[model samples]
Target: MTVPTEEVAGAGAPEPSAQPWWRSAVVYAVYPTSFADGNGDRIGDLRGLRERLDYIAGLGADAIWLCPWNPSPMADGGYDVSDYCDINPMLGTLEEARALIEDVHAHGMRLIVDLVANHTSNEHPWFRAALAAPVGSPERERYLFRDGRGAHGELPPNAWISAFGDSGWTRVTEPDGTPGQWYFHTFAPEQPDLDWSREQVRADFDAIMRFWFDLGVDGLRVDAAPAMAKEPGLPDYDLTSYGDPTVFRSSVWVDSPQWDTPGIHEIMRRFRSVAREYGEDRMFVAEAVVSSSQRLADYVRPDELNTAFNFQFLKEPWGPGLRDVIDETLRLHAEVGAPPTWCLSSHDEIRLATRLGRTDTTAVHLVDPATAPTDLELASIFHRSGEWVSLASLPGSWA
Candidate 1:
């Protein structure tokens, strides 16, 4: 996994002025569960991550961005956070997390943790109270809880679809054992969306930021950054452009009532101010998937996030289309005075080699190993092996 120092330095050289370390630093995204299993329970923990600091440092990475390690129900792979201030016992303890942070700094590498502010696990205390409280109570106001439509309240509040291919609204059973109000879940029902409109929600996240920063964390990667804000009215989407069976279909409409609204920018501005309070070196990166490059740039405005994931590059084919995206991304990011962050693959997406070796690159769908055709020639050419290897082996070996 060692990267050539010359290449790393050239690719991540900061400008000759006072600039944040994140502006020009190679960051490795670590999905903790599978990164390294230190406890021998077959689950990666803080000890495992600490043990791998040398390995990551050897790879010439300037920082490591860890996926959510907070206490969670594991319903959405730890993205359904139950506690923002504590470490998941299954992963490790809060002391171990602090030790890992110090250990990472000892190796001269920064640590950026995933901040899942958009949602919380249904099992979270806030969500639990929301469920127990009567509809329209303050506890319910912390989350997006709305009464269902139609007679007998049998229908979802709106036709918004979850990212996981189901209705975004999940009905809860009242204390009397009857169907109650529906709660919004942008991703999975187990992860209910938090109402960012609540002042307490904003203040709570600000405190979370301070807690992590005070713990020696270098930065935060905001999860579901764009969906944090919704339009004033919970409006039904016009599914005409989304095509039939639009449950999991990608929405091209950036102005949708549920996605990329102006309120998100204000939230980002607040987050940016919080990060600055710790130090100018502390940073925030947005995981926003918007319609256009300009829309992506909006997340990294001078007063907003430090940078955003350039997802267009990951979806583009290796041809003129890729070049066009890169050119546009550079131009758009420059216009906003932010560097373009490129990623070929991610934990949520298919492996880069697999995507590049596929015959139909434009499909943009998750690869189903059971039904996908193996491009033996392409795989051999790209990976230099006839046998398919795991993502861990492919990149390390190729490098």
Candidate 2:
């Protein structure tokens, strides 16, 4: 859908850097709620974001990866997008979004927004239509809806486990009020995985890309990038097998039945093509939590994404473990000729400051701020901020 906006001219921005903007750029991730409150509503909005552009620019950021500003149920922190083209009413309006884009570019920085491609909010229009449609209908095919394995359809279709620690499949009630098919969700049940095998699903994403690019977004950060494609036949997977890191393939999700499955590269290539149509510098940075360095590199092959989050590096504790990961990452990415990407924090993961103070440093899950260690300390236990900055001095770092 075309996101309507009045004429908003790009401000007088500086020339592009000698290198690709993202290569040596510090892409700042801005979560909307607490960044600033422009309307005195105690929540962040585009107006607030604009007001702080000078402050952000002062920090020497090269781009802003605005965390999900799309209309959503707030499940998964706005990753459950209900409308891909429009801004969340709480955050701002379409016009404000346009102005924010212009403001961002005007400051000589690019804007990257989230593309929750692997799934949609359960309340999405297409998903609601799918729920209303009968089994075996085309609407149902747009998502991963399958009949239950049991005789009365009482059980989940497979034993697939969600990252949030529940059955990946959720059984739904039919329109006639009967027990019905189970739908897949890699995260919360509020977000249902889209069936990329469906052409309409893929096409809609292509349209979504153009809509944002037209609005002047410089790139897209693909949410749940690995889980886009799944193994065929909805087969049950051996959960125990996943614990053996050595056994995992270069794709990370090969034979896993869900993440980074066989056809994900093709889907990413399709996404890349869409971005390329806009411009070569219009790029994609995948949020890929893969099994190994090789798997991470595979996601950023030239034909696929321009870069992917170096999650292994993020999850490593300081010292030998961290060094090994960096070495391995550089080696693998060098092979693919893709610039390695690194990040300190992400919407889905714990902040670097908090994680650094934790006893179990490499654990990547988000913990309640109160329950987790307090902010990064200057004590003997925690590594200082300067160390981290120096370590991440190379290109493709996100803050």
RMSD of each: 6.7, 4.7
Q: Which one wins on TM-score?
A: 2
Per-candidate count of clashing residue pairs (backbone under 3 Å)? 0, 0
Model 1 Cα lDDT, one tens digit per residue, 1-399: 333333222212222225667777777889998899889999888889898899988876777889999998799889999999999898899889888877887777778899999999999999999889997799999999999999989899999888887689999999889999999998999999999999999999999998887777888999989899998878876867656645554325655888888899999999998877755677888888777888899999999999887777666655667789878988888888888886656787766667656655443333334444346565555564333223223211111
Clashing residue pairs, backbone N/CA/C < 3 A, model 1: none
TM-score of every candidate: 0.87, 0.88
The runs of at least 3 residues in candidate 1 whose Cα sits more than 4 Å from the true structure, single-residue gaps closed, are 1-17, 358-399
What lDDT does model 2 reach? 0.79
